[model samples]
Target: MKIMFVGDVVGHNGRKAFQKYTPKLRAERGIDVVVVNGENSAAGKGFTRKSLDELYQGGADIVTSGNHVWDKKDVLEFIDQEPFLIRPANYPGEAPGKGWCVYPFKAKNIGVMNLSGRAFMPPLDDPFQKVEELLREMEKECDLIFLDFHAETTSEKIAMGWQLDGRITGMVGTHTHVQTADACILPQGTAYITDLGMTGPWKSVLGVQTDKILYRMQTCRPVRFETAEGPSVYSAVIMTIDDATNRATDIERIYLREEEDGIGL
Candidate 1:
């Protein structure tokens, strides 16, 4: 089975890039499933119903999110009803919505799990322990498992990958918004990458306007953050898992941009 995991989709432009390239890429590559991170889909801060619908229309079979999932406030209403939309599993038990889901795919149950790392991030439940428990539960019914670890440090992601090697199908990191070059299969069998990167605002800092971030850094003051405008980049990773063995055989990264950033006169 071929699954493509897209990076965090930022504001309007990121959605455009996703809507524009996702279908084309799926057709060109024969991808069977697409999972996207949409926490920042609403104007680069939070996601809403409209943005969620746009992702579904753009070919996302499932949507995953990170810390910003609740920024919109309205999400608390619909999240529980969305079968395939999941948030980090380590959140407090009282939090609405689920953290893992088993997607039935062609006679196989593919479990997708989302988790957040605590290091340098919100002090949620420990991801290391939380993921282990979730996996044990999912393993009861899943033929393969996929994990999206929304984290801050590379070390946390790498550690999780190592711990779950050969135990899960694949694991992809998100939240940093910067694509890493360490896409590789672990010694056991799991496919892993430090980060899938950001899919919005090709020229801005992360996904924020350059000047806005610049002013904050220069003045040591807080200001409202705005998503950048103009052409955007689409970041994603494609992987192939052997259904019979429930292990990943290959993993490849994709970073698409319409503009030339390296050209110098």
Candidate 2:
């Protein structure tokens, strides 16, 4: 099966890029499934209903999120009812929505789990342990498993990939918005990427205006964060998984050029 997992989509520019390219990308690549990080889909913060619909329309089969999932009150309520939307599993049980879901792709079960790290992030359940437990439960019903490790530290992301190497299909990191160059299969076969990168203007500072970020750092004052605007770029990973082995046989980084016409670019 060929699957494409996109990084975080930041604000209007990200959404536009997604909508403009995703459908054609999927068709041309023969992509069996598509997953996109929607943590910052709404005004570069949290996703809204309208934004969610837009992403769905853009050809994302499932939408994964992170800490910012709860930024919008309305999303919290809808999460309880929506199945495609996923929040971090490491969060407390009382948190809204679910962490893992078993989605069907071409008659095969694909289990997706969202997790968050505690280091330099909100104190949550132990992601390593929590992921193990979730895997054990899903193993009974599904052989294909995908994870979104939304975290800040590269160490945390790489650790999770190594730890879950033979057990899952893939583990793609998000939250940092900066794509890493470590896209490859682990020793045990699972596909892994430290980060899928941001889908907005790569020229900006992690999808946000550099000036505002620098000002806050220099002055120690509070200011609103906004997504950068301009010709956008899309970064993601395309992997061909071996259903028999439940691991990726080949993985490649896809950089859709600025003003590109379709997904294969």
Q: Which candidate comes out best when scored by TM-score?
A: 1
lDDT of each: 0.92, 0.88
> Which segments of candidate 1 are over 4 A away from where they belong?
260-265
What is the per-residue lDDT of model 1 for residues 1-265, given as tens digits with 9 covering 90 to 100?
A: 8999999999998898888889988999999999999999999977789999999999999999999999999898899999999999999768999999988889988899999999889999999999889988998999989999999999999999999998998999999999999999999999999999998887899999999999999998998999999778889999998877878999999988767542211
Query: For residues 95-133, what per-residue lDDT tens digits would candidate 2 score against the true structure?
Result: 879998888877789999999988899999999999989
TM-score of 2: 0.95
Question: Candidate 2: where are CA atoms >4 Å away?
Answer: 259-265
> If scored against the real structure, what TM-score would every candidate get?
0.97, 0.95
What does candidate 1 score on TM?
Answer: 0.97
What does the lDDT come to for candidate 2?
A: 0.88
Give per-candidate clash totals. Answer: 0, 0
